[model samples]
Target: MLLAALFLLSACKTEPANQGFCGIIPKRLEAAMSYGTSLYLGSMPDQEFLREDQGRSLRQIPPLEVREDPMAVQAVTRGRCAFSIFEESFASEQKELQGLKSAQLLYGYPDSVVFRMYVNPAALRGEEARTRTLDFLDTLWSDEFQSKLEFYGLKPVPEGLRTQVRNDLPGFLTTASESE
Candidate 1:
């Protein structure tokens, strides 16, 4: 039993380091999976440093717990890649990439599937905003969004936005802030 336990622990080692700030994602220093539903990354750079073949992960933070579901958190910056496609279209197509006007997307990985929803009490109000949010999420889960994720290498695409988790965004931000 002791030997079996040891083997199991060893077997749980994380994936080989391939995803980094300048690798799969342009902002690649390192992207990590956390105990909670969030993955944190850092070492942002300016646009001048951005190069080709680099991209960001789009994995949404998972839920920490049922109680953590309603807390809206801001977007976490993994790294600054001026070349990242997000930056390229950030202003021109912000609404197209984001599900909620109050919520934003990040570059993530395949193992950490992102199914996130955010509600901003200030910006998101009234029937119009609510309707937009629902429509955005629905469109996010559609084939188009999943394909977008696949291109960025964030896979195991979520079934839908019904799996919204609130604590993840906060958790990711905390990780990024503390590490800095």
Candidate 2:
């Protein structure tokens, strides 16, 4: 009886191990540029935003453009944006952006900001893993996570500034990366 109880206890205590890639966002101009671009292109009223808006409600306005630029990515949500870090010409502009501490100020707008990073999703057991990864991203965008980001140096972008930057995403990403 004692041995059976011990075995059951140990089995119940077993937990899954963390197995995934460990990525790093290099503190450089490229990262900053990518972040900025994402902020510009990913904000609400952007293409993706319009699509979601249309899907949810019939009165949404169509976006001016349907296709994203080949060189950029965006978030198009209230929480975050997607920016690319691997542009080829980003190495040359490092000198021009020396004093820009945060990507938020690079655009000369106080309310909007860009985010950059290297994310390693946990080792997924199957197709469901992808879904899990997206769920994890949702948590990152939660208000609780945003507060933590502010503590680290990133600032939350306001809705109005987000609209203004949506048109200049590619250039912003390229410039920021080069400056890095």
Candidate 3:
């Protein structure tokens, strides 16, 4: 009876399959689940390092125009590229990439935020799963994705700012979560 009770308790303590950061789910996935939501809802600088780049000021630009301009599209594409590289650099340290997906929110930028959900090795099984995941990620990085980001207040991450945010994700998540 005691052994059976112990087994039940351990099973109850197991983490859910669908929890954790957008890119990687942890063993304690629930503790980190809020982090992913926070990343989507938190207020990131509209333009990172805008002031340093040729005196361009993201703050000065109207949000509507930012959403519509070709240059802005290019900038966002660059930012996404940089974000991908950054994600890869930290791949071993973080969880495996599940694929990029978006969640819709009325108040968030672009009306939706793109997320790269990570998959556990336990979850990876067949070729179909892998193919679908890759396709989703590709869509998320396409021009359509850039348009979505622009529709929200977010612009492409500047290289310098991207580095800063990558370095500071933990602290940023903490602060953002606390405020909520």
Candidate 4:
């Protein structure tokens, strides 16, 4: 009986989902000119946004090729594409990696890529696990982590967005937990 109870307690112990969650990392992409004569989009989100805005705010621009961000940078570095959309942080990092010297920022866009905290579905299975997961999610926004965002080529979530996410997180957490 003692051994069975110990086994049950051990099996019930919930560990924090440190590796199962993703931290929020806000990043924006910039349209950069390199060597090609035509424009291109590196990320799917940018392509989708441009497509949606084609008839409205971006009527003057034509449809462009869509490629992975790294491939877009490579194409520009290799002089295959004239311009490409690159995340601000990735642009700087890739320039150094590709030994690119002539890439120029053509236009700045609003924050379009913001990663949100996502806890593993398995972590929301029980009350203790849910609490631990929620606590872990909150720590992602701590000052220490926020301070390191720039170093990782990410921007801190703005206060407004932070508040919005904070307001919405509990509902999401509760829903996820209840669903389990």
Best model number under TM-score: 4
Q: What is the lDDT of residue 56 in candidate 4?
A: 48
Tens-digit lDDT track for model 4 on 20-136? 221111123112111011111222234555455444421222222334445444433333222234444555555433432222212222355433222223333345444544444
lDDT by candidate, in order shown: 0.25, 0.28, 0.26, 0.34
Tens digit of per-residue lDDT, candidate 1, span 1-180? 111101111111222111111111122211211100111112233233232212323112111111111111122112110011132223333343243222233334534323333332222223343333333333433444444454444543344432342223322222222446
Q: Provide TM-scores for the models.
A: 0.28, 0.27, 0.26, 0.34
Candidate 4 is scored at a TM of 0.34
In the order shown, the candidates' Cα RMSDs to the true structure are 18.1, 18.4, 22.0, 22.7
Candidate 2: how many backbone clashes? 7
What tens digits encode model 3's per-residue C-alpha lDDT throughout 1-180?
A: 111101111111233111111132212222222222223223222334323321432111111111121222221122111112122222323332223212211122342332232222222223343333333333333333434443434434334533443443333222222446
Which parts of model 4 have CA positions greater than 4 angstroms off?
A: 1-112, 118-123, 176-180
The clash numbers for all candidates, in the given order, read 16, 7, 5, 2
| Candidates by lDDT, descending order | 4, 2, 3, 1
- Selected candidate, larger lDDT, 1 vs 2: 2
Q: Give stretches of model 3 more than 4 Å off.
A: 1-122, 157-180
Structure candidate 2, residue pairs in collision: 29-180, 30-177, 42-76, 90-178, 93-178, 93-179, 94-179
Q: Report the CA-based lDDT of candidate 1 relative to the real structure.
A: 0.25
Ranking by TM-score: 4, 1, 2, 3
- Put down candidate 2 lDDT per residue, 138-172, tens digits, no spaces: 33333443433444455644534433443333233
TM-score of 3: 0.26
